[model samples]
Target: MKVKRPGLVTVIVDLNFLNVFLLIVSFFPKSKFIEQFGFYFNPTPSFFGGYN
Candidate 1:
């Protein structure tokens, strides 16, 4: 059996997307949009535990 890895371009794009997502979350940590996004991302209360 053989395992396949993501190509360099895919990895780079994923990292870039992660960076931009983090930037947006950081810039508006207290905004309703972030809160809603976080909830949908992880419905657990601990999702935003540190922020509180």
Candidate 2:
């Protein structure tokens, strides 16, 4: 179902998500931060860079 929110509210939400995504994709401990975002699809450190 589609719900409608005020334009200003939608923009704010999108900006928040973008900021969070950028933080997760940059900096050290990226894996830890991404895991915290509830995105379980990314491979963990053990499975990354062929360590697994």
Candidate 3:
């Protein structure tokens, strides 16, 4: 079976969602997970629809 790779748009969308999730996580002051993955919330809307 041949596995097809996702397009760039799909990858960007996925990353955007991840960034949004991390942003929400940031709401909680006690959340340390986001800190570990720092820099994910720096994405601009022009790049990934503001999910960063």
Ten consecutive residues with minimal summed lDDT in candidate 2?
39-48
Candidate 3 residues 1-52, lDDT tens each?
9977779878999999988986778686455665676634444466656563
The most accurate candidate by TM-score is: 3
What TM value does model 2 have?
0.44
Candidate 1 whole-model C-alpha lDDT, 0 to 1: 0.70
Clashing pairs in 3: 45-50
Whole-model lDDT values for every prediction: 0.70, 0.72, 0.70
| Candidate 2: tens digits of C-alpha lDDT, residues 1-52 | 9999999999999999999977757654446666686655544466546743
For candidate 1, the TM-score is 0.45
Listed per model in order, the count of residue pairs whose N, CA or C atoms clash below 3 Å is 0, 0, 1
The most accurate candidate by lDDT is: 2
Model 2 alpha-carbon miss at residue 19, Å = 0.2
TM-scores, all candidates, are 0.45, 0.44, 0.46
Model 3 scores a TM of: 0.46
The regions of model 3 sitting more than 4 angstroms off are: 1-6, 31-52
Clashing pairs in 1: none
Better of 1 and 2 by TM-score: 1
